[model samples]
Target chain A: MRLVTTNLTFAEVQPKLREVVDTLFKTVPAGVGSKGFLKISVPQFKQVMEEGVKWAVDNGYGWEDDLKNTEGYGKIEWADASKVSDKAITRGINQLGTLGSGNHYLEVQVAHAANIFDEKYAKACGITTPEQVVIMVHCGSRGFGHQVGTDYLKIFEDAMRRYGISVPDRELSCAPFSSREGQDYYKAMACAANMAFTNRQVIMHRIREAFSKVFQRSAEELEMNLVYDVAHNIAKVEKYKIDGSWKEVVVHRKGSTRAFGPGNHELSSRYQEIGQPVIIGGSMETGSYLLVGTKKAEEETFGSTAHGSGRTMSRAQAKREVRGEQLQKAMESKGIYVKAVSMPGLAEEAGLAYKDIDEVIDTLDRAGISKKVVALKPVGNVKG
Target chain B: MKQKYKFFDDIATADAAFEAYGKDLPELFTNAALATFSVMADLKKVAPKAKKKIVLKNPKAEGLLFDFIQELIYLKDAEYMLFSKFTVKVADGKLTATAFGEHINPEKHQLLTDVKAMTLHMYSVQQTKSGWKAFIILDT
Candidate 1:
């Protein structure tokens, strides 16, 4: 990815695009106890890190050669098994392909549609469907990531007092990349990241299988391509030009995305022409977007963009605001079919609970971190 | 004792409850857990037709609380069941409990947006002068 040259000039991101408006809702997982596919063991779970999409491919989940375009071939750098904690192992054992509840989603989105501004860019990123059934999975390392973060947050806080690293917030705590603790944390984090990539890949495979059964088409005929996969809660050690010099900085982007534009060395050489495809998932009711990283994004937001419409209300609040049954009726009126355990989850996740997604994307566009290529309006969703 | 839930002006947090009754931590936790569920579906219509025991490992105070909510949500999502009475105990800080719930009558359970995941953001638990208070972020 040599993005020293980005051809995205008239390429300002459209932020919140709405062309398909319905078909996107037809895909993905939602809600509590969302299916994790088959029961997997802790040992095979370790294989998840070692193989990434390879495990998925081996299990008839995805393509082994898909690694060519994946970031680090979908495996995080040096994900040693020893780094993951026992509790993380317990949580990961059963949650291999499960889409964790709340905000994390498996959505059916129409990635790109119409001439909506950047047609050339959309075509380059393989957004072929004027109304395409693109399956998008939003998940992470599950309990593994949460436990690693929780376990290490304690370590970092204790070390902070030892090292005297001044920080404004305790949550922003960090140890240098060179230290023993930092290295362990990095390894553990990498394991989680790889697990997440593997998790999504597995879910993608399950989705393809389900779609195959539903549409009566082979996986190849369905063309469930892996457009791009990015981690939201992640940190990367990448070279960013700061103060007119390439600085190897550890970029910590929590609740933000990596919006890398054209000619970046980190990207696969094949994608250099269009820029990195960035996935921004909106609420079930709101829909999602596909944006490309901009050079301006590198300059601003630490090469980041907002992860999703930041929640403005709690599930509790949404529950209070709308009854689950009535909300379902409302969504049905809008032509979106939702299946959930309770109305509270539906109301809480109601598109209105968060900041206006289009506004958030517009903010990112104005900030110049990323620009929209395709807008997907969800028509169907599966709540766990 | 009745404790009211008030939403602190939070961006990611939607519902919150703070209640304290008696000095019993278990009772306090029971109240907090019930408070969160009450916001979703009415427990009045729910009957204790079946009882199930659950165990979660490495359960610190916070992890136990998190797993507790997740377990209930899982039962609801997977089994179409919702619990009313939670007889929970934190022995040596590990979770051991018997919960009472029944299949969610499709006609009764209010279906909200399924909570996708619980977030570490703005999560906290503390013993208040009255009893206990906890804040959690539910990914929607």
Candidate 2:
């Protein structure tokens, strides 16, 4: 029931998290290049880049406090409107609230504890039913992000060569936090990060409407509430236990999620006992999970864990190798209803193309990075 | 001969450069649009009955060729047609191309991910001693 800005940091909802996660994803927009419920003008879009979820809420999309529970309270500290190019703006103008495609999506799931920890968290999050529905939304900044990344890559790459930085991979090109190039990238990235947060917020509002339309009930009656939200893709300058003095380190979480442990002020006061909630989205066919950050996370991975089941094949390769109709038939057999803008997209995101999420969870758990809280099974899904 | 990159241009829904480079930059940038139209239908069968003189602005010489090919892909996707051949000149992000193509079928073709769009992902244009090279990542 809370807006994500202030209180819900991943800590308090550990118990009922699986149900929360399953229920949440069903509403949020996700999938590679999934479009949003609405569009905004470039000016308004710029506001989104600047204000994050608050901008959407101010525009009548969400609650004022929703930003409180959100990471960075939706607005990134380093966002720079100037850093975004006109082409990026052009690409993003019509796509402000879109989900985009690929692993991004909105899915409905159910959580029942097969394990004690899962059960405990489910109870705490008020997810009492083993068959309770949950939603999961997996997405980033969409085309805006792509453009930002692309736009910045050239700048940073040129800067890298200018500054004489040699990295193993072109994709890994980055500048130091103190450098001018680094500063520019950070500012631009913040803009994208804020847009991503706002994008999810707008998508969540649309989800509420979709639910109300389908179920014929008010959102409040359905008890659709945001459990927690965290972003792991961007890098941040934060206080970490570096040399035990909480030195500032630039933590880059690519394809990862921040798993801040219990007792941090970032979490809602109520959730301080459990820790920040960690959301892990799996492929559409397999399922997802809701977990709590561990104190040990600070030591292992800078309080981060895997983002989703990483892609096993490129989309082009997927299209070249797989068929859409056959892929849809397989999903239907498993009782997961599917709808999409493109059949080829369904084939591209075929469940077989990813690593087993169950195994991924096992590795995370065994690795002691993020502990498992609850497991979700899919019911309905839509992808682009 | 056929590059694996999905797309090179951002908004490719109309008339655009369709580079299909194979062994050389000139050829690769020239044929991308042709390859794109082929995806819509049979390029060999299309009589090139409809011809249009077209040009586009590519931001970079190498990426511009990539963008040209993506433009052809966009046209095919939106028009359900194909363009067989093109001649292009790329400099300082601007591309001028003369393209000839025709309408065709889709069901007979194998459609890949309806590319939502393309953005510079691993987009690079390099010239080797033997030929030209480029890599593109399309958001499917």
Candidate 3:
């Protein structure tokens, strides 16, 4: 999720943002050989899966106030670590704070006051001026989540056969929602979701440390607080009206984000009067946006919106079209500094490979699903 | 004749899928593992500096292939190793293989995107009139 705070203004940190970009690229572990900054044993990894961000905050990585702004207060209630497989635990043990490769990045962006559409709502989320700089960290449960999915696909395949359920494709293999296999997958998924929440929380701590070093001030002095955090690519049981009758159903959001409207009980207290913060990440060469959910979204799209600018080109095509070094120089010419592990990796995520984010956001705005609050232009980026 | 193995651009826009073929089951499994790693890094540049043995058992042939490729992905993420050479043997629903590769040196090796996982979407392993063929999609 992307985060904003009442921190240093753009002018005050422009030069440092450059330095911080390099520092973050080097400081934060990325790619295959990069291990996490903090080491955790299997037991500690289990605790992370169980407690999520609360575990990080309890360990002094972040403050309690940080939780107040996070989704679900940074922990999902249904997470059961016992359901997580040992293979998943082993994959997550050393990857606690590291950002994985391919589209995962830490970016520093500036939100101009003039660009903000809703002054009251934007201010409530801590965006006050054009000079205020924000940080956006995009990542997920990493190998842990992948392993869980792999382990369950095999289980579900067998369960599907046993239940005598057949689908058009093998990929669609699934058991009844009330069955034991279904419940077990849901519990294991919650653990992975919690692991992802903990991942973002720990990365925020690293960002604060990087800022403190560059500005010669503590994180508190900088007022670096989390604006909001959201989860994508997960399933949840949500109550919604169907045929004029309220019913409970599992809302599966893949490549999407939950955009609960004002007064939705799921929102944190600070955002309850407004709406859930919906983060739409753009390519590193392009800029991202901050949005607030609308009642229309709840009525229409099950309180969900697009997660990112949809890809328009394949990675192979992107590599064939542009060189990473040339793309980096172009970004630098536009004042967006980049640090990446490999040039080929960078080429795979070129801006030309994606749709115009401004157009995508405009569709959501014109459609009344989510309203744009502020536009964030990138200043520094650390990519894996 | 079609090549032993090659990648096809997925219509889903971001991922890549591959088809592997062999005259026998073990050869088909070996080719599939090679195709999976090729998606992550250039296989030609990887050196056989180290080797590890992997053993897996599954009641079904497709399950064994899925688990085998997943095991390689796990090693890539957890141990930071990339295997370029594989020798696989399958007998009675059991798979044993010796994989050789070195630790990922970012400076020396120009790594591509990390292959996150093997997907069941369009996953298949079957026998054809010519030989054994398998198709698998990777989540990048």
Candidate 4:
């Protein structure tokens, strides 16, 4: 998500945004063999799994207040480091503060005044003008999360037979929620969730550094505070009304965001009166959005909302439809500076490959799942 | 002979899916490994300059094959290597394979995307009229 600042116009920072994108692109490439900004030992990696965003801030990667703005205060409780496998720890050891490939990006955007729906909410988020600049960092737990999922799939598959459970598809392998295998997987997943939070926190720190270097101003001067961060892919145990009775259930929101309404205790006090901030990331060429959870969302849909514009075409088809160079030029023509490691990778994420973000958000708004707070137009992007 | 492996774009809604064919289980698994790497980088450019030995065991053939491909993905992220050639041997629900590739050279190998892990969604390994076949999906 982007940091809100005053009087930062697209024209003034266009050059700087381009430079930042170029630097980030060169610094973080896609796929294997790419180097990360931070290097940590095995012990430090364990700390990341245990502490999440708090670990990043303690390591001087971010401010302490940044945790307050993050979901779950930047750390999920019950994340047992012992649950994480040695392979997962090894994969995460060196990949901290790095942005991985395929649709993961860091973009510089402006909140257009005309698109601001709720002035008070926008101001509360520190955005007071159309010229206000924010940097959206999109990444996750990297290979650490991947390894955790891979490890659990095998474990769950094996446990299914022991528990006399069978599914039509192997992907649906499972164990009883209260079973040992289930609890262990949950703990391991929480570790990955923390890894993702820390991953974004570290990347935000790097973004701040890049801005500081380019503008010759401190992050504090820029008011580069995190507005809010939400985890889209994960499961959480929460109490929700089911059949007129409150029931404790696990909500698995894959490609969705938790949009708890106003007065929800889980939200930070600053945003408790309004709602949890939800960041919706779009393609490199298309713009993004900032929304707030609603009471209706709580009553319906399990307080969930769409995470992004969503893909309309397959990657292979996207690559076949548009050449990367052509897509890059098209994005440039639209005044969006793009820095990428591979042309094919760039082409695979062409804006046309996704649904219109405005339409998707409109649907959410109409459904009362979430209400739009501000619209952010991308000016610069670094793709992996 | 029919092609050893080929990718199907729509087989998965959000992943890369492929079908590997072989006259035997070993050849089927070998082609599956090749298909997996091909999704990560251009296999032709991945030189056979480095060799890594992978051993995996499972009570089921499908599970063994899944683990075999997952090991390759692990090596890609852990060792930063990309393999284009493989000599796989499967016996008694165990896999022993010698994977040949080199360290990822960004200049030489144009990476398409990172293959994070193999997904069991619609995963299958079966004997066919021709020989054996495996269907696999990779989470990117």
Which regions of candidate 1 are displaced past 4 Å? A1-30, A111-115, A164-177, B4-11, B14-26, B33-140
Q: Give the worst 10-residue stretch by lDDT in candidate 4 chain A.
A: A1-10
Flag the better candidate by DockQ, 1 or 3. Answer: 3
Listed models, DockQ each: 0.31, 0.16, 0.68, 0.71
Task: Return whichever of 3 and 4 wins on lDDT.
Answer: 3
lDDT of 1 by residue, A90-118 (tens): 65665677665556666554443452447
DockQ of 2: 0.16
- Which lDDT values do the candidates have, in the order given? 0.64, 0.64, 0.86, 0.85
What fraction of the native interface does candidate 2 get right in terms of contacts? 0.08
DockQ of 4: 0.71
* Candidate 1 chain A, poorest ten consecutive residues by summed lDDT: A1-10
Tens digits of per-residue lDDT, candidate 4, A36-95, equal 768788888888898999999998999989999999998999899999999988777778
What are the RMSDs of all candidates, in order?
6.6, 7.3, 1.6, 1.5
Better of 1 and 4 by TM-score: 4
A1-384 per-residue lDDT for model 2 (tens digits): 111111111233344343443443454444322234575677888888888888888888877656666776788877889888876776666566566654567776666446335666555555565456666676667666666776666677678887889887566767767898788888888988888887777777876766655556666666666766678588888777766577788888887888877887777764677777778887788888777778888776788888777667655456667777777777768867676545776776777777798899888888888888887777567675
Q: What clash count goes with each model? A: 52, 66, 2, 1
For residue B78, give model 3's deviation from the true position in Å. 2.5
